[model samples]
Target chain A: MSDYMKRSFLVALWFVFLTFPLMVVKVNTLKNTVEWRWMNMLWVAIGAFVLSLLWRWALERRQLKNKEAESGEDESTRLGFGQRLLVEPKLYKPVLAVLFVATIAFPLLFDIYQTNIMVLALVFVVLGLGLNVTVGLAGLLDLGYVAFFAVGAYTYGILNSFWGIGFWTSLPIGGLMGALFGIALGFPILRLRGDYLAIVTLGFGSIAKIVIENWEEVTNGAKGIAGIPRPGFFGADMSITSATTYTYYLMILMVIFTIFITNRLKDSRIGRAWMALREDEIACVAMGVDMAKTKLGAYAFGAFWAGLVGVIFAARNTYINPNSFTFMESALVLSIVVMGGMGSIVGVIIAALVLILMPEYLRAFSEYRMLMFGAIMVLMMIFRPEGLIANVRRKYRGHKVMTEDVNA
Target chain B: MPEITNKLLEVKGLTMDFGGLRAVDTVSLDVCTGEIVALIGPNGAGKTTFFNCVTGIYKPTRGDVLVHPPAKKSQRINGFKSNRVTTIGMARTFQNIRLFQNMTVLENVMIGRHCRTTTSILGAILRGAKTMRQEQETVNRSYDLLEKVDLFKYADEFAKNLPYGAQRRLEIARAMATDPFLLLLDEPAAGMNPQETRALDELIVRVRDTEKIAILLIEHDMKLVMNISDRIYVMEYGKEIAQGGPMDIRNNPKVIEAYLGEEADA
Candidate 1:
């Protein structure tokens, strides 16, 4: 304990030294003077000291748990809080019921602005889950995932401007377009893996954005399409506020649908094949899983969700420029997947909410938001590398064979 | 002893070259139904390279890999993809134990059932009656295989958590889930203790007698190779040194010199 304290004190001093220039000395160019804030340095030292101690304690606890697991302790004891909740239906059933009611009543209780933000968060939930199929399940690092999102948005935007297609009709069309582009991208990079795949996908994302910007004839170049009509309720006329509420509900339903389908797919044969492909390509193929087919399926499936949500995004905003589908957007969605825990549905939803909604509400810390985000990400990497909830494989319970049967 | 029936796999004049160096040279081998054929050699003898050629991991420079399934016609599978080879009723395990480490033991086996089951993306999303039945069947079949390998208790455990010996058995169980006519074992007993090796010997014979599947193995354990193999093929420096039954192989002077060293004539 004394050694830990000494180490933490040294870390505190190091942080104080690191932040001294930025926090303590501020140059006032207009006044031709310098302001020294020694108090800020002291605060930094105190905060760092406490945080380092906590970090070490958490690391020690994690190591202890791992040792216990290695020694054949009950596996259930090692499950995270979220996993424990999920495992016990008695605990989760009521929690889920309350959550279902709260979501259904959310738009009615909250104002239009809040509902709008909720819609945005739900869109990201879908996007994170979609990318999870490729990156998490199939182990395909796709740095250009936003390209598919752009394709879906552009699909609806172009169709609406040219032929005046409605939201209902273009939804599936957008998803299909996204899947088509996914397959197109997947075909050329079938042999690439790891960092190579990431670089290629990053290029694909940049290429997509550039094409959208340059193609003036169809996309209107930088001048994005506007006035894309909201989804209709049997052609019922509704105000903007009501339309926003309608979108919120639609997104809720979409999130539910995505969760249901992805959950089912994670346990299916195709899903197992994708995971097997991710684990070891050679073994997967040796087990008779078609490599090309499984990989293309992951790409197409992941992109399909991105496309579906892209349409919703355009319709909800009623306008989209090339700026909306930038590389930062792709990185943001990827971060959500990473921080939420890859291949975990519940984790993604929670992470999407926290990430998307927190920034909106914490406008006071706007300037420091990115800095805090980077710090948290670094901490997460050091501690919980598996994200909030690590993915757990489905288990099967088979009837025990009788002792007589074995004898016979 | 069961008669060695029709040939299940026949590799003729298999030769593989990497750049200028020859890895496998004109190594012809065959396995008949209800037989356990062992390919024995010292390190760097290209036994693994030969397995890779036959399994389609490496397209041999000049060879013919022919397979005769139980009711299917004979087909040449040279240059085919590894997955295609597996789907055509030939499955192989890796020398280093390539079970899906992160997935459950049952899931590892279920992945092997990929070729036999047909469920499209739409089928998975919709999950109709047919899809559910197939999934249940896969689970049941995978569980049965785990039981056969005496790993049913660890069905839900991650593949990486299994002990060294059980992991080898799991590989065999996973390969069997592919329903192959011929199973290729690459150094299955490389790291096993004598008791574990004895169990593997029984497992191989049981798989042959009950499932009617032929096995081709590359092993370095002389006791295991001699005890279990119906016939043994010896290779030295990528060349076939000798081929005969276990008794004949035990007495062969060439195999002894290749394994140990040249005798000093006194």
Candidate 2:
């Protein structure tokens, strides 16, 4: 056999050996008998053999592409499919228009259940974009990002329970509260970076949850707050279906606002500073970018969106507990940002929809949902570590037409 | 020496100690307005360490760094944050070419304009009339700097995608975007071909002549240093061994020994 065939055979045999107990052997304790399924072992070997061949082919192709990249060939022509879809307005504008129409028509056509799920997904879309500012643009590994979401939720929950405040009033307040907490968290960990920053932020997230769980007087102490009112419509009460629709549209508007601001900021001076800070802090500082201000700005801006969405989440649920603001929620939102594309707004939206909707729609395969999610993540990392859509830097044109006396 | 009154940067008795090892030991240097000062030394001669001290990258254990802007008061600037140093009209390029690899060349230079431009987060999001004007001005100025360095054609290319020489020139353009009165270049010609080095020599002179920015560079390329520098300082074993004109340093026995090794007694 050739070397490739031999390697594939060895891989197949190794997988068969590794999976022998799980796949090939079954014990029936009730019948006091053991059953051996040798055919399952055959299936495992065939699957592993084909997969190994494909894996080797992919690795070889990746190596060849990397060599070409290092040779300084035309890089723009190598834009990924998702990036091309975004770069070409003719492609994206129609797609966006279709998407816009679909979203508007979704609640009318689908049941309240589907609209609710979409609202949840939109919440994550905002959260992912917010985290993109800190983790994607600023290059800060924030593990406790859910703490800001919790702060926003609790801001609305507590305000409504105590003072009988409404949702609209608490929306901006919740966002600002999140920003305030973000800056507070940002101050202590300014010197920490990478894994250390992640650890500290993770601790902060756990602390926020524990504080809410214990602080009975303010946060209801794990019994959770309930009966938080839905948003008001100019003093007119909205029916349950209309209210869900209202919140759905509100979330859509929020996503658009977030995208608008983020898109503008990406090419602005402050945004460039953050990207530079992400690339190299030492060089950024040398270039006259204030490290502390830029870092705090990222944290605050990111938290603001989380907080805004948190208020809506509380109003939609009409109840919230510490259980909702867990580390898994943070991880899910982070995965959306990573799987979509860090610093790419469009990527985050698509990722949020797929990640959120897939679980809901795949009820038949619910048992293997997490398994499939993990596998997809691993495969994505192996093949496209830059995420589903790599963020393309903004390009300036008309430089050739400018005269040398432009500065003069 | 025409009175040497326009002293742009002055470092006196600067020393930096990393744990038990003294990396830089009492190195004093000065650059006046309109002068290209070169800091030359053998490897591990504490030249970059001194630059770090002067640029506020390191808090010198014992020293004073002062800058006298042309129309501003003299201020002692030792131990200031590096960003603060740049804000005070001093910008620097890295020894290892620390350009933001993923950002476009124009964006990298625009970052150099960060301190000079004033735009709040709201302003950026809103893009008001004033903010838009400032942004246009920033882009124009950054592109102008790129053109000056002959990298205007690659304005939209990522900084990492540029050739090595172009990357070096991009660094200069980015630093110039800060509109600094004094520019500190850490080995600008370290890895350039002779032709690129010659181009760099011309660029340095043009920057000094046209922009009127004073330059303090640490370089190993002897030819470029000799051709462009108005004055040269030689360092050995973390100490200043010689300070004079290029011709004087070329003929100095102590400098020659430090670079070429000490001659045999015979």
Q: Write the per-residue lDDT of candidate 2 for residues A53-89, one digit (tens) a residue.
A: 9888898899998888778667865787789888999
**iRMS values in order, in angstroms?**
1.4, 1.4
User: How high is the lDDT of residue A340 in model 2?
Assistant: 85
Clashing residue pairs in candidate 2 (N, C-alpha, C atoms within 3 angstroms): none
lDDT of 2 by residue, B150-209 (tens): 998888888888999999999999999998999999999979999999999999999999
TM-score of chain A of each: 0.95, 0.94
lDDT of 1 by residue, B118-217 (tens): 9998999899999989888888898899989999988888898889999999999999999999999999997999999999999999998999889999
Q: Give me the runs in candidate 1 sitting further than 4 Å from their true place.
A: A72-78, A397-408, B1-5, B264-266
How does candidate 2 fare on TM-score? 0.96
Report the CA-based lDDT of candidate 2 relative to the real structure.
0.91
lDDT of 1 at A378: 82
Model 2: residues with Cα > 4 Å off, grouped in runs: A1-6, A64-72, A398-408, B1-4, B264-266
